[model samples]
Target: MESKSSPCRPQDLGKFEVTQRDGAARLGKFFTKHGVLNTPALLPVVNPNILTVEPRSLWDEFGFRALITNSYVIWKNEILRERATKEGIHELLDFPGVIMTDSGTFQSYVYGDVEVSVEEIVKFQATIGVDIGTMLDVFGRPDMTRKEIEDAVRITAERATKSLQVADTKIMLNGPIQGGLHQDLRAKSAKMMAESEYQQSNFSIHPIGGIVPLMESQRYHDLSEIILSSSSELPANRPMHIFGCGHPMLFPMCIALGADLFDSAAYALFAKDGRLLSEEGTYRIESMVEWPTQSSHISPYTPAQVRAMSKPERTSLLARHNLEVTQRELARCREAVRNGSIWGMAERRSHSSPHLREAFLGIIRERTDPNEPSAKRIRSIIRSTDPIRPSSEPLSEDLLHRPHIIHANSLLVQRWRPPGSWHDGSIGAPSRVVVMKGGEPPWRASYGSTVQRVLKEDPRTVVMIDSLIGLVPYSLEDLSPWCRVEGSNIHPIGTKDADYSVDLESMGLGGIPVLVLTPEGSEYEQDKSILAWIDRCSFVDKLSVLCAVSPAIGCEITDEIRVRRSNTNRPVNVYNGEMHLFSPRLNDGGISLALHGAKLIHEAMKSARDNDEGSTITTTK
Candidate 1:
């Protein structure tokens, strides 16, 4: 007998994947039946009652792949409700891209009640064939009592299974997380919605709801806390939407904290008031002599000319300008993510608003404590990233809190063992750690011979390179990203005496004596003389950082090492006595190993951890 067909799944309707990331912020692609939408993306809120700009223009002219409209607005109007159900949302709006519908949650918050039942809106959205639909979540306002907020969260969560059951298989559903201003409730709500699976139905997106009031009050600190709390519990693969956030000024910070989707009516609302959105902040046309922000919509005419136009004309012009600013800021954020510099961009943008700056500082100053739920959330973000990066650039004091750098430092403390062996078979006490100073990368050139000479004098000495963050062992001169800053004369690359002991203390090497010097004062030595030591020690460092193995065990894997020298007489490849086991990257100095060598590291990982002095740094904040 022939088998029956398989039932539809969430992936059958839509799929989401992370393409690139920095900290918690990521670039994602949402695949749907209509087309792929790249995020972090904005969906301009469309009101059925009015069309300020044609929906077709949003697709062809403005280049947006998705938009959001209120299904309740359509459901309330008999003409719109019938037309949408008959013709579908796309035809009614006259757009070809992905469209998402809301289920009157905000309307309920505003009007205190809605005529439709909870399941009615979900079924209607399915009937109209919206690519994505939001459930009828009860909006949890900031001023509500704790009991009220709890009820909101419980009710919203309870409605998820019914909403998912009613939504069409072709319609990807959004399950909103509602909890007012309480972070615990926010996390609780996210956990419930993300796991709201019932048969062939589950939410495709989780939007942090009840945040419009916070945004309205400029409660950016609370906004950030809400994001961190929900993001910590939300699935990494699914996207997180910052409900009602569209101001360009807040884009960098919101993206940095892990918002993948956003929707706002601010562009039209602000435009009606004659205010223009910009990367820095909003600008009022009446207060402007000229266009402070140059966009194609406003570039042709002077500010005075725009102000002189009729109200309807000016509002339309300003709305287009606001959209221009919004799109430009998102592009800038995507570029920053590629550069591994989104935090720096967030830093620069934060100063434009006092409240935003405070929020940014709160993230920068957060501490990792097991007792603090917020701290645990920050830890999840940092620990989730791969410390090895694809690009290099100049760094500053700003990178001290970089998640990548923190992860590497934590590994250095937890997995790395000090260099010093009495013989090839036994470990010895580390007497002195020679730190190379006033030298920049290519550290192999500036301090290579000096390190060799120091090792020649005291073979038990551990060689280290100084950086703006701290002192890292010479094995990581290039591999530990903090030491990979570009340009020889940059301040962040060179070592400073003030940071020496503190760094040593953190690494649990405080008892060892440190002697700081540069190649300029030292006698040169042949490069080949120390390649064996460099290869063996570098192997241990790489294993510690990347493979999470203790240096003691990593040493066992590299015991039978045979080195291949580059044209510059530097170690290029490592042979485990006979088998080719390791190859070091020329560009970044990171290690690449043969599959056989990977097996060895994998076997040794059972005991991977720090010694008495070694411990995992609270990898974030």
Candidate 2:
């Protein structure tokens, strides 16, 4: 059945806008001729030859905004080609939302070359009204040699311009990045596609192509490297598609790494193989007595009953179940992104499979590279200091190098008010740094006497409470995560057991002598050695928590900043210099700068000018 109303064709197709972001993950909208695709979204693969589940059901029932089909396959089939050309691909597929079409690249990789020319295939997809059409580029296989892969990249780059030219203004063309398993070649492919002359207007999406083999072999580390290497170089405005990556298990990690679109036939293929998809891994249907998950399609029937049904009937049911699982996982990922816990989700999912864990570690290592393209994007997304959220599990060492954490730490060192003389007041740096260990608020009550004694001995002493997440100062005791996060093992600061000297230095406390203060059952007396150490240590006060939350903007404020309590006396607004930064108390909510407050902070950071006439003190909800 044809769509009753024609789809809205946007004037500027492929224009992507980031509506929400958490770390490197973005909740965005990619406009297309068919409709706006809210991402990170899954495009279920629809094979024209076989219908496991109707595309309409995917839109109406499952709420899928988009689906992908093979244009080369439709073109090769005479009857299907005639119907597609006459009625448009969307009508033939019976899908009203966005429809993205592939350009035989995967087919050529699998079947050893397709018959259609690059230009011909792109033109066919555009003529058939495909919202997003992929260019017929060479798919570099992981097994190929470096020289062979280089050649593949070169050929793909050569074909990109002509394919995009054929696609023209009528449809948005996908510029697929191909470099097999070679990191350098992947970067090269990304650069070529992003900078190609054809990219001026036509290219809408950047799909990292030819990694299906790596995924199939469970070489997830290599896959992670390829994605990071390629995405780093691509244009930031365009949505990135992880070609042939459809499993629900891989979605969170890929999305965290900045993948916006995913297409795969895993739903149907796994269904045919009687495998069930879950966030953890695929489970074999025959081996399970009970359903692994709750799905409307499979919950009503027993496994034995499902097995007894005809092949088509069973495949359809399982296919629906697989799609349901895929959709549910994507929803979960989107929620995590909105909540600023995409990294936590990715970390949790990594433990589901050893390969995924290896891949996660590999990504962490690659992020350390200064030249990594994803680094800038990651830093941009993680500008807010509160992205490291409290999870059911304790914050692990893995968070030490998380792009967001690093960004937060950097900002803290740069912006937070150190204990020193300032334009607004003279707080002065501490003579000694006290790292408070093992405590819960009211921290003032627990360590109030200790802090008083230390300050009395040396008025410049800085007392920092080392929480599970990071080091926080006595002034910001009521601040979240530091105050709200609960954990059993709060490691002692300055001990060889937990080495955070570099982190401390990064938070602008380098060269300061630290005295580790351990409270025994909520009370402790300082000995002579501790007193002597306090005399030797340099002073830096109220640096840790400010740096922890607003690493970039925290240190810059000389004005007295206090947390304004809500009706429940919960810390909500950070008031400083006629400005306030609102941070929701929930674990997932991020710190949002009120419009006027943003101007004040930006001006203080010297990142913006004070040209506006209005008072910068106005509040935002």
Highest-scoring model, lDDT: 1
In order, candidate lDDTs are 0.80, 0.73
- Candidate 1 worst ten-residue window by lDDT: 612-621
Encode model 2's per-residue lDDT on 1-621: one tens digit a residue. 334334554564678999988766899988876677899999999998998889998888898889999999999999999999999998899988899999898898889879998888988998899888889888898889999999999998898788778888888888999988877789889999988766466478999999899889888888777877887688779999999999999999999888999999999999999888888998887867888777888889989899888989889999999999999999999999887778878888999999999988877666456766544434544564353454433466675655555664455456454445322223555456778876655565566567657665666666788766577666555444455453434643334456658857766677889888766444556554443222112111222233232322343442345556568544466666556644434443234456665665556545423443222422110
RMSD of 1: 5.5
RMSD to true structure for each model, in Å:
5.5, 6.4
Q: Total clashes, candidate 2?
A: 18
Over 4 Å off in model 1, which ranges? Answer: 1-11, 168-170, 393-397, 422-427, 486-502, 518-523, 577-579, 603-621
